[model samples]
Target: MSKWKRLQENSLLLLPSVVLTLALGIYPLLWVLRYMFYDYAGYGNELFIGLDNFRRLMKDTQFWDSVGNTFVFAGGKLLLTIPLSLILAVILNGRLRGRGWLRAIYFMPTVISTAVISVVFYIIFNSYNGMVNQLLLKYHVINAPIDWMGQEHAMLTVILVAVWGAVGNYMLLFLAGLQSIPNDLYESASIDGANATQKFWSITIPMLGPVMQMIVMLAIIASLKGYESIMVMTEGGPIGRTEVMYLYLYKLLFPVSTGSAVDQQIGYGSAVGFATAVIVGIITALYYYLSKKMNKVF
Candidate 1:
């Protein structure tokens, strides 16, 4: 075949993937941007209101509450999940019996649907009849069952569930990274009288920089976008206590119409959505910058 014909054929082969990505990914983002400036109920005529939506967002108490919840949820998950995954990856990387089985067990949770995990955890954390309370009670840890899904602890419970479901995927990623490191690095460190802790600090961590960056980026994005699990588990709560940004946006978009004044704030919800996009974008950029800095330091 002629070179020109081959190039043309390759281009044709790439067309479907490019078209699908644009249709599914790029188009929706563009649609959301358009909707951000308009006062539309997802049905009627869209009236462009310029910065009015944003203005309303600035004064909206619920929007701020959701923002605070999003931060807490994301921070809690990142703090616990990353370190735990790294530890599990390190253990699993060693030559131990049933290593493969253990790795599979750790990674199995990631493959389960988030919706299913949410439902299961909801039952597990139930205030009175839940497994967690029953276990605590049986063990004499608490005299009475704590309200795991109540206003005070609901957000914490959701954050814990998210971290549990997420750690497995990052563990696998870290394991792959650990395996990629040259054995000679460890050998040299040991020869230089380095202890296990020193060797890990000097060798394992530096080499795993890129993998850690990717894992953190993925985790942050997932935490920021947390919705389905929260929706299925708490439905934004016994109150708005567990309402993260995405769920708050959902409530705004699909108001329950319980005759509450705040329930009709669709414009305000769109504003919150736009604010969330901005916050997430800033965080992603900051993470990229920090990752680059860490890459240099390592």
Candidate 2:
């Protein structure tokens, strides 16, 4: 067969997956677009509404707050996870005794269920008798146990927990990048009278540029998808101080916010979902453009 015909025949193997995606994914998305311009109660006839939901969303303070919260959560995780993962990867790159076990210990958290981790962290940060509070109190850091889940500290607590759970996965990515780097480069640097720190800064970091950029993009995308941990731990509570975009979208369809009832908000929720999709699209496009530019620079 000719190349074009051969390719067409091979694509037949993926027919099932394409069909499944259209049925479950594409159809629901198109349905959302249709209903975005109409008001429905999930049961009754959808009344046509033009741009009303978008206008209201433009004026929502709570939704804007969620945008800010989402950025904070994403930024906090990136700030902590990247450097820590890189540091651990660098340490493990050396020939140390028990290196295999140490790598396993760091990677253990990634395999654990996020639900279980969130639950464990929730208890560990509890006000009265949690491990953190007890340790601080024993050291006489404070006379009273601090409320980690309260308004003043809820977002910080959530960010810390997110960082802790996320570091392991990113560390593996960085470790792979480190290992792929040829040993000859380091040896050559040493022959040229380069110290460990000098070789690391000149060779290791420069070589890791592309890999680091990819890790950053992956972390950002995964952070955008974060909802389950916050849902299981905080439920966007303490007066919505820790509410991110995903949780806010979730609350729209499930719980009846004081501003609007559930039955009248099908279009509203659809609008929110579409808007969030647009934001994700913009971020993804920006990431690809930046990655291309950085690749040229590196």
Candidate 3:
């Protein structure tokens, strides 16, 4: 076939995907952006009230509260998950009996459905007659059953469940990065009288710079998308204590809230969604830029 005909055929093959993307993705995004500047409830006429949704969002204390909860959840997950994942990866990367089984067991959680995991964790942390409380009582750790999912401890439970579910995927990623490090470098360190700790600090870490940075960025982004698990597990609270930005956005979209805050404003939801997308974008860019700079130092 002539070159022009070949190009035309390729374009024809790509047309369906392009159209589908526009229909399912780009179109909805544009529609949401349009609604962000108006007062719409997915029904009657949309009032073209300019920027009012965002204005209300700015002063909305509950919205800001959700944002704070979001950061707490995301930060807590990263703090615990990353180190645990790295430790697991390092151990699994070593020569050991039952390594295959161990790796498979650890990585299985990451492959499981988030909803299933969250539901299971939810049951485990139930206030009364739950496994966790039962264990604590068995160990004489507490005299009575503690409310694991109650307002005072809900965020803690969410963070714990998140870390348990999150560690596996990052462990797999770290395992891949660990395996890729050249054996010769370790041999060289061994000959230089370097201890295992010394070699790990000097060689493993420095060489894993890119991988570490990648894991950090991935974990941050993954934690931001923790809505499904949190929703399934907590439904935003014992009293809205576990509400994150996405859950709050959901509440707005449904005209749902703890009484006195309910309003069927799809426009506000869209505004929150837009702001969230922008925040994600900014964090992504900053992470990559910082990673590049740190990689140079390494």
Candidate 4:
């Protein structure tokens, strides 16, 4: 067959997928772009307002609070999850009995539903009858029951749940990266009188740079977009202290009401959504730049 014929056949094979993606993904994004410029309640007439939505976002205090909360969530997850995953990957990469079982145990949480995990954690962190407080009291760690889902501890609790759900997947990624590193490098390092820490710093980390970059990017995006667990556990409650961007947007679009009334602010919600998209885009670009720089250093 001629090269032209082969190309035509390949294009035919890909056409369905391309069409589906445009219909399901690209069109929705275009719709969001349109909504961002319009003042439209979901059921009302949409007014073309140009950059007014963007301007309103600048003065939205709740949007800023949600932004701050998202950062805290992302930062906390990154700090705790990445190092923990690395350590777990390193340990599991070593020669040990029951290694497969240990790896499975670590990864099991990632396969479970986030909503289920959130509900489980809600019960575990209950102020009066939770297992965490009961254990702490039993061990003499605290004199009284602590409210783990309260405003003071809500953010921390959410962070911990995020880390727990994420570490497994990242550990698996690191493990695959670790496996790809040749044993020859470790032998050479050993011959050079390099300690474990030295080998990890000079060899393992540098070799795993690409994998680390991918994991960090995933973790940041996940944390920034976190909602399900927070919704199930705290519902951004205790005076909205744990309200992240997505939750705030959700509430804005589908405002909770009393009795026979409905409250809707579709325009404001669209504004928040657009602002979040901008922030996430900037963050992703920054991550790409930093990853490229780090790759160069490594």
Q: For residues 58-98, write the lDDT of model 1, one tens digit per residue.
A: 88787888888889988998999999999999998998899
Model 4: lDDT equals 0.88
lDDT of 4 by residue, 145-211 (tens): 9889887999999999989999999999999999999999999999999999999999999899888
Which pairs clash (backbone N, Cα, C closer than 3 Å) in model 4? none
Question: Model 2, which residues run further than 4 Å from truth?
Answer: 1-11, 256-264
Is 1 or 4 the stronger prediction by lDDT? 4
Query: After TM-score superposition, what is the CA distance of residue 160 in candidate 2 from its true location, in Å?
Result: 0.9
Worst 10 residues of 1 by lDDT: 257-266
Per-prediction TM-score to the true structure, in the order listed: 0.91, 0.91, 0.93, 0.93
Instruction: State, as a TM-score between 0 and 1, how close model 2 is to the true structure.
Output: 0.91
Off by over 4 Å in 4: 256-262
lDDT of candidate 4 at residue 82, scale 0 to 100: 95
Candidate 2, poorest ten consecutive residues by summed lDDT: 256-265
| Residue 104 lDDT, candidate 1, scale 0-100 | 90
Each model's lDDT comes to 0.86, 0.86, 0.87, 0.88
Q: Write the per-residue lDDT of candidate 3 for residues 1-298, one digit (tens) a residue.
A: 9999999999999999999999999999999989998888878998898988888988988878888898899999999999999999999999989999998898888889988999898888877878999999999999999988888888998899888887888999999999999999999999999999999999998888879988999999988767777788778887778889888787778744433266677887899999887877788899899888866875
Every candidate's CA RMSD: 2.5, 2.7, 2.1, 2.3
lDDT for residue 102 in candidate 2, whole number 0-100: 92
Identify the leading candidate in terms of lDDT. Answer: 4
Q: Backbone clash tally for model 4?
A: 0
